[model samples]
Target: MDSQPPSTPPSQKHGQTGNHSRSHLTPEEQRRIEVNRLKAKAIREQREAEEAKRIPHPSPTRGTNIGTGVKRSFASMSSPQGPATLRDGRTGAIHTNRPLDSIRPARNFAKYVEYDFSKMTDTKGGFLTEDDDPYNKALYVRDGKKEQKPAHMTQKEWDRHQLLKSTRRDDIMVSGSKQNTCCECGSLEIDRKWEEAFGCCVCSSCKEKYPEKYSLLTKTEAKEDYLLTDPELKDEELLPRLEKPNPHKATWNNMMLFLRYQVEEYAFSAKKWGSPEALDAEFVKRESEKKRRREAKFRSKLQDLKKRTRVEAYRRNRNGPAGGNFGDDLGSGSRHVHQWGRAQENPEIGMDIKKCVDCGMEVEELEF
Candidate 1:
């Protein structure tokens, strides 16, 4: 190594070799590197374009520093050589200026101009003077004069004139009154016309005799009149014949009797058929039997569970206690020995005592 330092490779000697250093790579690797380089370059150019779109345009007029709050001439501000610009006083951001019309103009400009009251006159036809009225004084001006009715006219004349003026000619009738027939008594001399009560024409005598029956009798008489003039009958026949009762009005009992007869005559009917009530009772009985069976199954399951528990208890007792050192572990053994001694002494304690087959711990029996 002291004789000569290892010569650096041509590819490593110069850092500017770029793709030349990659010459040792396969053609596919070389192509992939070139594609990646082009993609990075395209991305950089796209970012530059987006930045350019975000940057604000420089003001055309001189002496205007876009984001600086400096007032400029009105002419320069209004000029459309480029978009007008303004500096936000608070935020310091440059924004495109709005036109004069975009801002709200002074409201009620005409209100400031004093009205000329010299040419105006009062209701008495006198000219208004500034000295006579204060500037803050309010003046109520009626638009026109109203014509007053003559006081010399008679009451009847006044009433007739008012009625004629208020009434429209189209609503007035000039013909004589026509005779109306009484709805109740069929009299042509109907003294009172009840227009609100279904437009009935009832004679005074009939109305006095039966006021409530007038409308009812009128409606019935109209219905009779309509029936008498039926289109199905000839004009020579003034009245129509009575119609039979509707068959659809038959009672439930009649329908049941008809159905019974039809079933008796039908060929495919069942030989032993019961009434609806009897059939309903039979269905109820079958459902009751099904419910009883379900209850019996539930009872059987409960009994079986109880029997299994009793058998488990008996087997546990027959197998003796659990744990190899049942009577040797002083801690648990002492407690069990005490319980066992007591059980032997008292028959009731034996009935209540139970022992675990695995742990040999004496536990009290659980009563269901």
Candidate 2:
């Protein structure tokens, strides 16, 4: 069978109700639709740009056409404006932030003008008088162009005006505090609270307190080695006045010390990462190895010294007994001393305490 062109919808072909309801559009409608879409897109772009600028950190670059299209579409879908309003059609009386729409009603409001003011008597501060005519005052109405106000006031006028009064000056006296001073160390006037917050100020004449966290000393009475405890100086005393040092000096010093301690202690804390921990761990390991070596050497030397002592004591005990001999008699012919075996014949041998003899006592040799 021969293939035929797909049948056009009856509705589309000659305005009949159809199986396929494809409809044709006029060029005018299509152009109108495109124009409306473009206008809507522009408005949406303006709103997005405004919102972006209001943010803390707006992107410096202008958005691409594609980005603008996306932003516009999203903004329109989310906003309360209707499609007709977006397409530049006459919008309904919808509440909005747009200035024109918000102020339109106010612009249409009838202004009050026919009221009489001549009957009004003078109130306090000369605000009004009975002879004054309200309409003749010529004050600008809301509908009229805004007029610039003049700024001119004499010194007396400003002084007389209660609204323009100068601020009252306050005379606040801050009493100086008595600081701790160490005459021997030449340290003076250290505030503990300030030191805890900022850092220690170590002046040659005065030692300011260091931060509690970063201090080398623990919390307790200050000692000579870690800290100097001095009598508190009275404010009235005429002692040497030291120059006021920067408060941040102690703070910075403590911070640096803290950083150093962190680096040193990071080896023990398992949470730290990177090269800081790695370097410190290696250093600690080496130090531990050195300590172990030193301890081992000390123990080895101690053992040797103990063994020598034991040997000397044994020799002394064996020789100190009755008839105890070192090994040989004074007139021995042989060089060897035989106190136990040949003492009767040779009479030169001395007791050997290192060996066990039949008597159960240690013998360097046998006693003569």
Candidate 3:
């Protein structure tokens, strides 16, 4: 048998064969190959240019490491240990690293300089020194001046001053106390109940004496009294005046005056419409009837709303998992009972049934 030729390696065989095969191609093929070669070369050069642009330039001072033979532009020098070996450029003198206070001037330097005052003059064309005199030196008129008591105060003056100060102090104390005195008896005693209700103070004795006037009367009663006294007022004007009671300045007298004004105004308007007393009675009756109807309607709507809310809550709990119905017992009526009964009859209808981990009983389990 003839010895087989040595097998060619896969890489070398394909490379060499490809080159040789391309070389024997037609003119068109050769041109195509050349064009492809140039395209690849251009692409490589373009990539190289982009990479070079992305790199940053090296700093002059912060050059390559010392071992790389690269040198820095300037050397970093530490502070000198003793007197500086530098000199001042302008003065051409040696400069030392001593504290500023320790530096001494040259012997030839002048110690003092004098200013010429002979040519100086005031704004009025008078010599500046013409007003100066040895006997008339500048005096600090305001600096030493202070408000001081007379060196010798008379006994009468002292007594008057003390009396004025004591009176001022007493007035301040009285105002700050905010205590009300009864106008009738000039007594400091206050009726707290009357004050709280009417926002005004009146002594018990006065209130007892004038029952109809000061006996903790309601705003309505006061208004009626005012209307009885002045029966020619209008409601349009009266209502606004009655509504705006000044609580801060509200004394018994002030409140009564306001009520009286409201009633008088209402009566005047009522008289224009008809008999003042008859019109007032009719108005009261109509308002009371309207109020009753409104309250009844509100109650009916409130009940319906509460029922609808309960029905919605019941529906939600019935459809959801049994374990999440934690508040089912909080609802009222047979609806809640019926839901509980349904849940018990079909335990697996709304939730998964699982064994309890602790008690090992068949219990409803929630799926997360």
Candidate achieving the largest lDDT = 3
lDDT of 2 by residue, 86-131 (tens): 2222453322334464443445465633435556664667554424
Error of 2 at 80 (Å): 99
* Cα-based TM-score, every candidate: 0.17, 0.17, 0.21
Residue 247 local lDDT, model 1: 45
Ranking by lDDT: 3, 1, 2
RMSD of each: 37.0, 30.3, 37.2
Off by over 4 Å in 3: 1-273, 313-368
List where candidate 2 sits over 4 angstroms from the true fold.
1-276, 279-283, 310-368
* Candidate 1 residue lDDT tens string, 190-271: 5421422234566778756874453232212323322212232222122212222334574322111111122222212332
Task: Please report the candidate that would top TM-score against the real structure.
Answer: 3
State how far residue 235 of model 3 sits from its true place (Å): 12
How high is the CA lDDT of each candidate model? Answer: 0.48, 0.42, 0.50
